[model samples]
Target: MKYTSYFFIFILLVAGCSDSELEPDQSIYGYEYFPLATGTYQVFEVTQTDYLNTGEVVTSDFQIRHEIAESFVSDEQETFIINRFTRANENDDWEYLNTWQSRRTEFNAIVSEENLSLLKLVFPIEAGVSWNGNSFNSLEEDTYVLDSLSFPFRLNDQGFENTITVIQADNQDFIVSLDTRFEIYAKDIGLVYKEIVNLNYCADENCLGQEIVETGIEYRQALLEYGAL
Candidate 1:
């Protein structure tokens, strides 16, 4: 085995010892998958802010990601990455990857004795998204505070919040440029709707409209729902 791997284990062992070590940072995890164990699974992240100008509802592409194996090491004792995330969007009701290359969504685990995943929204970490420089052992060290992602104006409300902080970049250069208050998401679930905040990059004051409508996004479009908001 890789010596670095052994070093990784030592890190976890000294990290801590607890029962809730593998718990998710977000409650949404339970609504989707509770009692999560070591295995591969999928989650849908969704969000719906508002068109500051027209109060129009704009949706984002869904991310399909897998949570591979969960393990406890000597120092860190955490989960490992088996697969990265892929972004998807449906064209003519067909789901396709937003990119032709490896566009995986990854996340950092909450570094704590409890190891609870408290925040799983978009801007914070772009729920269901993977990141560079982040690895299986990221949680064993850093505090996992995502600090830079723009909030989509079309998807905001007066209660706009930033659950995840992101510095979004893809294989190519294409962007919608939503202000910095971007909300983290879960596929099919639509807006984590729990943690919201205004980011410094907030470009628009009218993030979401006061005149909110249900839009009835769910139950009507299971495809979109499953596709992730």
Candidate 2:
């Protein structure tokens, strides 16, 4: 066997170390999976279903868009990323909606909208990992669990890609109510689809035993397009 030169061995070692050094830049890696930079935008198609007390169910569909409007650091030394969200029906002009802000700490990514603040995502994503996302919500506590470690999910026929889907309230009491949510995120992209179904029902005077009469609402939001600017 021929002996290798010290210069060649040193060059190979430097190349390997250069790649390993990238792990220290947390921001870059995190942002690649969930971009929060300014000018990034994503559009979604929303479908809503509402059940009235009169045994009537109404369904509506619309489009919603969220844009990263601004990014700044507060005096508390926390970086806040602002997002402008809007929605409209088909062939209709987009109406301005409210704004929201998000920031990431060492453990979690939090989003604050209106008077509500909650955990949106947990860092170091892995399969079987779970967290209490609704700890900050005054209304109720919710646990967000990762169902798929690496899944091939298709969105709007956009072709299958590696993705992860986190589910909240996966188990439901169908006899009384259903408050379930599923959020799917694609690698190197943001939220691809979100489905929230809130249905609370009661029995009517003429209904059978445990039969549902009045229902609440169901909402579904799916990604239409995404871009980074």
Q: lDDT of all the models against the reference?
A: 0.33, 0.74
- Pairs that collide, model 2: none
User: Ten-residue segment with the worst summed lDDT in candidate 2?
Assistant: 27-36
TM-score of 1: 0.26
The true-structure Cα RMSD of candidate 1 reads: 16.1
lDDT at 41 for candidate 2?
A: 84
Tens-digit lDDT track of model 2 for 1-229: 2355877887787887866585677753344445567778888898899999788899988888787867787765455555555556657776777777777666677788766887777877777788888766786777888888567887667864677788876757766676788888777777888898877757454553463737787888888888874
Q: Per-prediction count of colliding residue pairs?
A: 63, 0
Cα error, residue 12 of model 1, in Å, equals: 40
lDDT of 1 by residue, 168-225 (tens): 2221211223222222333323333222222122233463433233232211111122
